[model samples]
Every structure is written in C-alpha cells, then in structure tokens.
Target: MTESAPTPQPDGLDVYVITYDEEGHEERLLPSEVTDAVVERSRDFGINKGSWTIDRIKHGPLIAAESQLRLVNVGSLARAIAGNYYGTALIVDQTPPPIDEDVYDIDRRYDVDVVDDVLVAVVTQRHPAQPAETEAEIAARLARIAAAYGCRIVGVSFALPGGGTPEEMLSHWPEGEEWSERFRAETIETLAGMAHDVKVSIATDDNVTMATLMDGAAAMADYLSATQTGPLDAAGVLNLLRGGHFNLLIGEAESGYLEVKTQMHPISAPGDTGKKAKVELAQDVARFANGDVDAVLVIGYKEAPGGANTIGSLTPVADSILNTAQIHELLDARIVPPVDGLIIEKFVVTATDSVLAIYVPKQPSEMQPYLVHGAIAEGKVEGAFFSIVRRRGEGSITTSAQQIHAYIVAGKRYLRGND
Candidate 1:
C-alpha cells in the first residue's frame, strides 16, 4: 500500500498568543504565528539580528533568538514580546492567576500579570439607591452564568468601592479604622454566608482582575467534579451541616434524589392526634425507595414566591414539634418492605431555628417497589392497596402500571441470577 502524507499535528503546547491593539481590541494567534511575530519583533528591537528558531519545551514552546549579548534574560525577552508586539501568551497549566493576590501596587498600576483559574465576581457598590444585592441574588446570577459554561461557582470574593488593599483592609478591620466594627462585621457575615466552604478573600484591583476570576472559577469546577460524591451518606451529610457548607447544600436545586420541605407533614402531632403525619412520612420514604437513587429530604427550607427556598424559621423542630425517633418508627410501621439504612437526624441551626434531614438509601433489587398501606392525605395514593410511589423532579407521583411492571421484571431477573 502507498504511504499517505503525514497528517499535520497541532502545537503540542496548546498555547494562545493574544495581541491587543492600542484601541484595546484583541487578536489571537497560534504557536507558529507567535514564533514569526517574535522573530520579526526581535529584529525591530535591535536586540537580535541573527536567525531565530522555535524550540519545544516540556513546559511550553520557546522562541530561541540567537543573540550576541552574553547576558540575556529570557524573562526580559518574554516581557519585550508582550510589550513590543502588544501580545501576551497563555499556557493552559502555567500562568494561571493566583487568587487572593495583590493586583496593584501603591501607585495603582498593573504590577503582576497572570491568568486566573477561578471566577472572581467583583460586586462593586454603585449608586447607593441601587437595592442591596443579597447572597441569594449573587448565587442565582452565578448559577445562571456557570450553567452556560457547564461549570459551578467554587469561590466568591468582594471588592468594595474605595476599599484599600487586602492587607490594609485586614489590619484596618482589627483597628476599626475608617469603617465601623459593625460595618466590617456585616460585610464578613454576608460573604461567609455565601462562600459555603469555598475560599473567600478580600482582593485589590491588582489581584481581583476579571482574568483571575475566570481562571479561578475554571479550577474550582475541576476540583468539584473530581471530589464530588453525589448523595452523601448520613455521616457525610452531617459533616457538611457542621462544617458550615449548609449554604452549599441549600444552594442546589431540587433534583431526582433531593427534596426540600418547609416543615414536617401534619404540622402538629400530639394536639392533632391523627396518623396523617405518620402516613405522609411513610409516603415520602416509599416514594424515594421506589426510585432508582437515594434521596435526601431537607425540612425547614420553605419555598418562597419566586420558587427560591430559604432556610425558614424552625419553630416546630425547636419546640419539639416532631420527634425524630417517633417519625422513624412510624415510617417502619407504614412502609412495607422496610427501607434499609433510613436515617433521620435533627440539627440545631440556632437557638430557635433547627432543621431535620431524612436520608433514604436505595433498597436492593430484591426489595424493589416499596409500597404504602394506610390512607395518606395529600399523597399520590390515598386509601389504596400496595401503592408504589415514585419521585419525579421535585414531587412524588403514583408509579404508572408500566413502571411497576418494569420494576417487577427487573426484580425477577435478579432473583433468577440473570441480572
């Protein structure tokens, strides 16, 4: 067979040379274009008149311009390329900007130039009349932006108008300089409430550049994707609660395996003296068990008018509105084919605010299609026999006859050693 022409390969470094004009417009170039530009620029600068060649380095591509000067700094050459050609190069791995670094010096000019790996959102205080944006608003905006790029917010930092360097701000906060203690405390509180285990920092114009934020957000998205373990176990969920990542948990929207409720069902237990609460709890558990994945029910998170659920006041849990053990006992009594690894825990968020989380793990194939027996008011099936309830996006619904049949067939296959 005749040999085919060797296919051209892309530049191994995967670097982009971006050149900006005096008008602040940008032009991106490939590795070859960058090499030609550097050679021509070096000749123009009178630093190197000899021939030049491109050398491939493990880190990235390098322009080796032959020069008579004995002491030539490569860093200086790189800087010249950027300044003279009005172009800068970026490597995917290196040159990524560091978060929480000072961007400007005392003169308020660009000092260090680097690419960023995270999303640095700069919340500037414009006109005082503008409504004060809440943490929720910021988070919602971030969610929309991140979703467009298939990423998530990993960190958030703030920049106040006339806020000095990060170091100055830190020292000033302690001394109560310029701004009052209450103002400083409120700023920190607001940031802490939104950070959700992500790193939050005070940054100057020198460090909190748009480039840095974008790079930081990218790095964060990678980290989250790698470390994520969906549907945490009871212990893992508890760790998130105590570790101040509760905001992160609540930030997530309802999905197949997650559900949020304003309060426990039946609202009242002793005074009402009915099985409504028990039945409702059982239905919830049964619905989760019938689904393909585990589920987490977050109580005390009420849905607002705009479909945003916030951590509402937990007077019920605080006032002993519902007992955890009792709820578990009731679920056991009502749900047939007992749910294994069902965990119900109460966490005291504040003195008067508390919340309950119930984790229902997916049962084995042999125990599929868990059913509810008693009449559950507002449930998918009321006064029905052997009702298999399945959870949809955010609500529970009665499983269709086709779905029930598929579940039975799968269970039979497992029993027959076919699955």
Candidate 2:
C-alpha cells in the first residue's frame, strides 16, 4: 500500500486556568498547551470551593480544537479534561453549540448565547440607606449606565426580604402605607417610556442576587417587547404611583393643569341625587376644557391645614356608586360642546377607600369656554352658566370681565396669527 502522510495534527490550542481563593482573590494561570494532562492539572489547581463556584473556563477559536480532536464532545470533554476544577465554561466557536449546552460548554464550543449577546444592566435600591436618592436621580443614573453599555433596560424590580407580595413588602414602609407600592409603580412608568419591559419582583431571600435579577429582567424584556403595544395599562398606572409622581398631586399647591378634590358628590341611587352629582362632575370637566393645557382632577385628595393636600377619607362615593361607564355618560350628557379626550379612572386604595382621577385634555382654541348645560344648583347663578379658568397657585376662579377681555384679545391674536 502506498504510504500516506499522517494526518497533520491540528495547531495547538490555548487553555487558561483561573482559580479563586476563599479571600476572593483570583489567579489566572498562564496559557499552556491544550492537553488532557494540562487540563487535568489546571482543574487540580482551581479545585477550591470558591474557584469551583466563581471561576469560568472560556475557550475560543474552536476550529483548532475540532481539527485536533476526532470526536468533539465539547461539554463533556471540557468537564472531564478539567476534572474537579470544572466551573462554568464558555466555548467560543463560529458554529452554534447544542441547545442543551451547559455553562461548561463555554470551554468546549463556540456559539452565540442570548445571555451573552444581550447585556443586562441592573440598578439596585437598598432600604435603610442614608439620604435616599430620588426616583428621578436613580432613573437618570441607570439611563446613563445603559447608554454607556449600549444596552436597553429590561425592567425595574424590587429586592425585598422573604420575597413577599408587593403589597406585603410595601407595608413595611412607615405606618404600613403603600408608599413602596407607589414608588415601584412610578419607577416602572418612568422606565416604561424608555424601555418597553418593566416589572417588580420580591426577592425570595434577603440577598438579591444579580444573576436572579438579570434573569427576571431578561424575561420581562422579552415579554414587553412581544406582548405590549402603545401605552402601558393599569400596571403602568401603578408604576406611575410607585415613581412618586403622585406626590406632585399631594404637594403644597395645585398647578393650573392639576386639581385636587377631597370628595365627590354622594350618589345614593340613579335618580335626582345621582343626576345632581353627575352634573357636578360635568362642571369640573368644563372648567378644565376651557384651560390652555390638559388637566388632572384627583379626587380623594383634600387641602388640609397649611395648604398641603392630603389623601382624604374615601367615604363620599360608595364602592357601587360610580363606574367608568356612568362617569363617561355623565360627561357626554351634561357638558355642552362635549370635551374630547376625557379619561375618568378609579383607583381603589383600600376596601373602603378609593380615588377617582379625571383627566381632561385641552380642547381646540375654538372649543374654549366650555359651559355646563344643566345646573346642579337651582338657585345659584354661578352654577347656571360659568367659565372657570385656573390661575397658577390660586384656586379655580370664575372668568372675570378683565379676564374675558384678555381672552378675546388672545383669541383674536391666535386667529389672525399675530399677537
């Protein structure tokens, strides 16, 4: 038989051995020839408990490894070669690794892993920290970090002890209030505009592991990207609350775009009493319709002593009193030149306590001066026909003769396209 040249042995591969000590010190071994003996020795050198858990064996340019081996059972071979020192190994190869590849496969194959391709940035908040940072500040910092890494934020999750429900965890805040819930909701809302995926999770233990958080974030990012479209839903509102933006409604004064109501007119039954309450609701809507910008009417928050608005008792409107349908019907029926973009939502704080938020969007300039058609109060002249304009820092004031003149002048300027 003709003598055949022995199959050329593949180029030597580089094997790196990394070890970690109990003191958390890391030592990386020099690159050595890839051989069963060298790999076995490396495993022996990196066999400490800490190294076994923390050290990762990574390999790349897998073409050389494949050329050298007859049958490349990458994962098993790597673990067997490393022996007891086998930790997490990553294989870097142009070809995709098997779907069942383990962390040890990092050393055995070259493939693109979703975990590696998608960078996860985690921003953590710990309780009992001094001089707490505001949600805005925290969000800004996270944004900058994500930008630096060119990665999208996946979600916002809370790490709490015992991993209780959001409500249960929030109860730990002072007075067992829902400040934590609101904070979480608000943070989610703020991040929602930036990243599609946002969520909240309670840690199973006191220790919040980055690995667990990254997993959750990845899942949430996938979900948000796949399922959600347009703006956020009720969950988004909760996120808004958690973000602390609701504090704006509770602060010292209401802006022209904001209104706070301690309570709504009680609705006993669907009769004259209910009609009166509906008409009253319409009046509030009309007031905002005439304003220059969108308005937010927050019911259940009342002005307390020292001008601070506090969340008031929710006894005014019974749980069965107003549904979304009734609120919409009332607005459609009572307000003349019906306001567009009015969103009425009810937020239940507790079993016996709840609040209603009426969002009134600004109407066109021609639609200004919206008037309440049916008067709730029979004798009061003010209730029959009125144009209420919100003055900054000042409470809602009825349109005065001077103000009307200014409105006419402004209207003329807008119409003529000149001041």
Candidate that would win on TM-score: 1
| CA lDDT for candidate 1 | 0.48
Candidates in order: C-alpha RMSD to true structure? 22.4, 21.5
Give the C-alpha miss distance for residue 386 in model 2, angstroms: 5.3
Q: What is the C-alpha lDDT of each candidate?
A: 0.48, 0.45
Instruction: Point out where model 1 deviates above 4 Å.
Output: 1-238, 267-273, 308-316, 376-384, 401-419
**How would you encode candidate 1's per-residue C-alpha lDDT over 1-419 as one tens digit per residue?**
99999864321122234445456665444434665433333212222222222222233322222222112322333333343332233212222222112231111111122224221222222222212444455455446434333334433434444543333444546754655677677655544433122222111122222333333344333323323343333345445544433444444456666777776786345542355565667778888887877677777665544655433222334636657877787788788888899988777777776778888887786676788876544543355555668787677788778987897787788789963
Candidate 1 minimal-lDDT segment of 10 residues = 104-113
TM-score, cand. 2: 0.40
